[model samples]
Target chain A: MQAVEYFEVECPEALGGEYYKQIANDVLLDHNLLKVIDKLHIFIDPKVPVFVAVGLLKKISTRVRVGDFANVNPLEGKMTLVISDETYLASMLKIFWERFGKEKVEQPDRFTVILYNVPATPKEIEDIVVGDPSESLHKDLIYALRCIAPEGFRLRSEIFTGTKFTFVASENTLAEDIDTLVAEKFRLMGEVPP
Target chain B: MTLVPVTYKGGIFQHDIVVDLIEDLGGYIVQKHIIAQEVVLQCFVPREDIELIRQISRPLFGEVTDSPLVGTEIAIVSMSLEIHHLPHPSCDIAEYVRRLGAKSNMVSLARGPGKRIAGLNDEERDVINEHDIAVYLMGNFETCIEYKMPTLRRGIEVPIVLCGGPDKEVLERIIDPPVEGYVGNVGRFMRRTKEADELAKLDEIIDEITRVLEKKREEIAKDPLSVYPARLMGLIREQIPEILDVTSPTPLTVQIAGLRVKLPYDTFAERVKKVAIEDGITLGEVAEVLPSRMRDYVIVKVLPFSETNIAV
Candidate 1:
């Protein structure tokens, strides 16, 4: 789709290519995996009864940090945190309790948490990471590829790199040289992910 | 007399005579429901005498429309109830068929997943055979469909219509032994069919089903059943009062051959076998009350005139 930077579906016949493009578009959109993918290439060889899919993911930079959700004030004896977003507050509190003692980290109100006798500076506290979007990118990419693969193609081999992924599926067992086949699909798109 | 199915939509007033009229014309009342002050009746009447019912109902502000799909049940089958196939197209087709007053159900297979592994066992086939017709929801790729359909269609005695992504011509050429119809653009669906073009695809499936069902009705009419399923349903409901105690949507599901009574087969088979029509001929003598594959229901398939030599 136009949402992705580059998309191509190669099939033995033009009809299958056209129909599979629509199917892939619907499936990827249904899984909400379209925006995360930057480039994709799909090759369906029905005679060989194999489906290969490879894609390049966009740089996901959204990592929720302490400073992003709350304002930190360094008091005389304690550090005060005014929580603005509560979505990741639980995870943040879990991390705080592990770094400091459970008794020292106290939540006095729903939106205010105080730490007594904290050793770290405000800058170090603000840099504490709470949530990262790229952690689940591989799982989501594999799931989307599985949905796009033909129904009976259950046997699968998947490889996910930092910003690239490849999925190969077939009804039959994977052949001895399946990685070479997957690499060939990536070659169709001008780059073979290693 | 050829029977023409019709549905009556009007107020509750003057509805008693409608049943009497159908019985007098050697027809049968399929279903009737009175809610609030309105009444809806589904019945079949002699084709030549259908106008008489319309004429008699004019004064009561009743409208009678031909409902060919009445008294027949259809099954909307999907490979599985997974998110890929269910709710969108299978439920959509079933809802569309029900809109025309036919009874429809959604059936999901347990073992029909992979292309090479897509298959239906005898129990699944029997469940599908319970319906008058079946519409199978299929995938987009022709190659996968080619490998999968033969396995899926095996042992399915009832007529099957395929909903997939290939054009009708392409499907007709690829699939062997030809199904009832093939509708493209109904492949995997992510959204409900709300737009004009999307709904038009649903209409295409409905139109195809109607055509095949109409043709099936004609074939079954050649050597007609000794009794009307509508009348048998009425008789079963009247004699076996326990039938009404069931909680299913439709206690009795009418089909091309006969009716499916939603009661345990082992307990009610003997009682249903004794439901008599006009003469001393009980249901067991004229029909086969067999166990249904779906749960513990019973299906009654009345013998044709050639077998019973009796017509009412």
Candidate 2:
């Protein structure tokens, strides 16, 4: 496929523009294409420590939740969901069992499950779960991206869900000020700050 | 006389050089090739031959050059960028070079290891050849390094060392012009040495490269530079105002006695003359500022007309 877009950021002075360039070039030149897009969408977060470039991949989403990802419908006042793709099966099951209790959810098929007495609002059900599944989603996405990115990229990413979920990937050069770096990079790219 | 039956599994850029070094130091290449599968077996002769084999194979196997890419120590750049393991062949070679008191670069061809592997691009080839010396690690059992002769066989101006896992005879016979040298080892896929033992082998390789580098240093001593690069850097900083904006800390560094100014040659040549010492001697009057042989940086060398004719 043709490269539809290209983005780059001038790293902050703390990140050493030259040093960041070396790492960026190393990652860009070495990334694997079969699993992930080699080209990056980069922007400098001025709020970040100098010499760091925060990157985002637009239009590429690998998030899977119970109702958000698969078909969830009501039957006899209960929710019968058929998850064709069990991307977050473990987290989904954990959330389901914790909210509905282990006896309330039954799995007849490998990818299909039935939930009884589930709340009408999926958001309400999502909230009942003690731990946030979005964290794991972010981690999975980061792991996938790392497997796809070049070795030199040394990527560190954080995924979050509010109205919409965002996946942020960055080179791990800035150990302490990663959040600032990422925010600044997003601002530099004109992305709305979290 | 002593053949250590050294084996290297993967393919590298300077495999030929390693083979040549092994033979020159009195080691015979036992078996060599790119490792296609996960495992392979090799046999060794008497332990007495180990020294001769090691001496010959030492230069072939250990680190021999200072790697400009990774500044501190030698590290192997594996063929598959995904794999991260200890005793990384590229890192092993890099350490080998460092032990010899020279820098080493672990280079992986753009295409991963295989018989149909691609050669280095122009930029990559230039970087690989830029080293004072290079150790190319090739694949084990696979013929990618040899078959892709056009990639590595191009005339290398400096010593291009080579290493692989097959018998030395295979490398000698297959390589078109043949590499500078070759070393045998278990295939790249197979972990040859236990953690501690592998480190010991790496240390041995480093020792061999040090000896070679020492000899090279002696040869270079015949004619010393009138001025060292660091001295010129200080002089240029004091003399030139425009150099401050160049950005490189080690700006106006030297490669073989000539100064390499990080400033753009085309834009800065005329402006550089503004730099003058307290004695009113301008840089232009003492040295010729021109484009570098390799990059866009300005190359400066003292001309015979300079008051200080000898490099201080």
Candidate 3:
């Protein structure tokens, strides 16, 4: 029941309600945002020259680790890794090459990686972090928000959190009540403002 | 229904034959330009006789294609040529208009963004007025659209078609005195329009242009000029051999009322005015020859026979 895949974009009555929904959908898909975000609400008031976007990010529990992406088998002094997901293979190889030097790490096939000098415990490779999706999500969300905002709305104030992000942008001077307005928009979208 | 637009591209050697054939078919040449050894003529052939013009083009090593809006010019006006106003919906619409055979000019103004600074200057207005119809792409808010109408109303004299992202009702409510037409579903589109809805919107804009142009054509028929703009262009090219040396792709551009000769107004204005036509009549007698608004070039507005009191 908590997992409501709700995404809504609202424009001021002056700007025409639901007018920018397609544009919002386009910008979201263009940035490949459908994979990470579960709910999004965008509010635009052309009269105030303000654009606000609030999104709820789906939880990414752990970083991409070497053990999750590859199978490491140690035999003698060398170790072989048969990768399952190539998405983190480059990062995993970078870390392996850094520790064992370039000459020791060899990838002959797309999925097989061989290390000449294996450490005492081959399972130690399991704890190595390849990448974090949440970190990149923060970056990509801002990008998607930029594409949806008005062209003249250059000044932006973004509030980024672990699970949610709220961005407010405007061309003119930010009035003192901008925070209130953003909160009001979030409330309208059924979001408990942070 | 009277004139059907067509484009002919062929070699320069036998181009005159094609031109004569088009003339014999009761067709008029809107624009003629020589690109290297090749010549391209945009024409308005009689709708019923378009097939005859096509047949003549076949023997002349020419390619003839339908260009519906060839004889007319349209201006797509926006505040800036930057990422906001251009290369998106405006450029997309302009390209669409070009495909329909009308000459589309993208008019970008300096300081054209922000409600406080978005207004056209005299030079910009002159450039827009040169076109047959001006399409002003308004913004979202009705109040903003209303605020900007005065600048366009004061500067533009030709028919105007207001286009925006809002509904037709919203756009109509804001515009005063009623423009020639109002087209909705066109604005600052960041991406291309390939969807069914967006394509339908483009069709609507083209329909508005057709309606507005039809009205203007009827008005022109009521009080027709002594010479058509295309005919006047042909006369200028023949009488003034010096125009060939100008080297501009389009030394003379045909307009609704007259033509704009791309020559310095001071030196060439008098020569253009003195051009003698077949009737042993000077251009100055049937036209108001003066300097253009954008540049020093001459702007010739051929007067109606009722005004000049001489029927051609």
Candidate 4:
């Protein structure tokens, strides 16, 4: 019935477990990460002073590229790109300057950009990958996890792949087997440790 | 005179009459303000004459209700300013108590999280004790709240009203002294307390606070102070013209049992003690003027009749 397919919280204290589940749901929903997370499992040990969270992310089918957010047109040896979405404009400009140099790229206005004497065709420019939603999603997802974690659990260890993530936090230094704890949580969610 | 605390809210029409009536009856008008078209008055009137005060306000389209918090300062205590306990229930509790005529201060403890490593220092405890009472905003877990609270509550010397997530009956069942100062369902808001249920819970918390304040009033009534705090506010302002220059909006902030004079204690403590009252007795003869732990302000705690053998 919920957007997320699976969400589970495990703790020694029953009330603490229920409260943490509510907190996790609220934090994820507030951060707009509920839909993108397919499964989430959290394990908290107040006595042991550890909190572990493991989550499986939904498959991101759409890869944002230059063509997806801008219109490309060939004019002589140069190409002009008129951006329709500016959410990734800053990152796009950074990539352009790094790849084609500032001398070859010129942004005249907010949405207009001109490439001069580029060897690549307009189609090649359109194919350039500029935005990765998963990259920012990982950051936001980790932030929401921290919000869900117990207060004063400042020490953190995080692992974020394109399709999976595991976050461990503690008031003291994290345990040496923090990965095992995360793997145990992932296993609770019916996922392989890998 | 049996002073009964109350508040009034209605139109501005004939509101001056109510003020005049309170003054004529020798009652105190603690605070009165006009917010746009409406006027709000928080005052204390003679107990037997309360009906008369209400009757005079009826024609002004105003209502008078008993609310002991009208002239007191309250502290809303939380674990810390961390994401766990701040800007949610702390803000909500402070706003609710302030809306009901009490001066509410949000007091966030410096290290008031985690059961083993959490505790409040002497200064933090004193700051919270400066108010009439403290309302502790805690998290959702029942066991954690019970176990972790005493550490955060260390050295605090004031009545504490708790607001948390666990059901009141359950909390009262477990906590010693039978927890009359517990309000539930107001824990850790993801948003503002704008929803009807959230506001209802806030109202419940305020009602609990009023009950606690009324209890304090009853205790004070047993051995009444020689001079009421509100009366001293006027005397302090009149005799000590220097207080008028003080930047605090309320130079003599009203507490349930005393007053917090904003003047520096080192220079003004002796001067405040020498303030003369009725019957040829100096203020020092009937009250204990102590250097307040809060900002070195002088605290004028009027002696009870049992101690001073005088009552006004």
Give the range where candidate 4 chain A is weakest over 10 consecutive residues by summed lDDT.
A13-22
| lDDT score, candidate 2 | 0.47
List candidate 1 segments past 4 Å from native: A65-129, B7-65
- By TM-score: ranked, best first: 4, 1, 3, 2
Question: Per-residue lDDT of A56-129 in model 1, one digit per residue for the tens?
Answer: 88888889899999999998989999999898899999999999979889999989999899889999999999
| Model 2 agreement with the true structure over B1-312: per-residue lDDT tens digits | 212223332235445655555445543332233345311112223345434544544544432222222111122334554452224556556655543323344555565333433445665555444444455555443244456555654655544445555555676777776545455442243233447766665554454334433454345456553433334555666666677776653454433334567787788777665556336656666667776544676767654423455443
Candidate of highest DockQ: 4
lDDT of 3 by residue, B1-312 (tens): 366668988989878999898888767887777899999889877788867766776777898887556767788887677655556678888888876767787887775655544567888888888778988876655655676677656868889999987778878887788898998757556678888988889888888987888798789889988877777787888988888899775688776667788888988888888888767888889999978776677888889978988655
Off by over 4 Å in 2: A1-90, A93-194, B1-87, B91-113, B167-194, B222-226, B236-312
TM-score of each: 0.84, 0.40, 0.74, 0.84
RMSD of 2: 21.3
Report how far off residue A102 is in candidate 4 (Å).
11
| Cα error, candidate 3, residue B148 (Å) | 3.4
Candidate 1 per-residue C-alpha lDDT over B1-312 given as tens digits, one digit per residue, 9 for 90 to 100 = 678888888878877787688789888777777889988888888899888988888888888898877888999998888766767777888898876778998888987776676788888888898899999888766777887898899888888989877777888888998998888757765567889999888878878888999888778789988888888888998999998899887899888888999999999999999988887888888889999888999999988989988886
Instruction: In model 1, state the lDDT of residue B255.
Output: 86
Model 1 chain A weakest lDDT span, ten residues long:
A13-22
Is model 1 an incorrect, acceptable, medium or high docking prediction? acceptable
> Over all chains combined, what TM-score does candidate 2 have?
0.40
Assess candidate 3 and give its TM-score to the true structure.
0.74
Give per-residue CA lDDT, model 2, range A1-194, as digits (tens). Answer: 24424345353332323333333443433442212332243443323212233344333444443556567666676777777666566677887777678988889888778887765564555334233443443444444444323233343455444322233433345466556755655665566555
Clashing pairs in 4: none
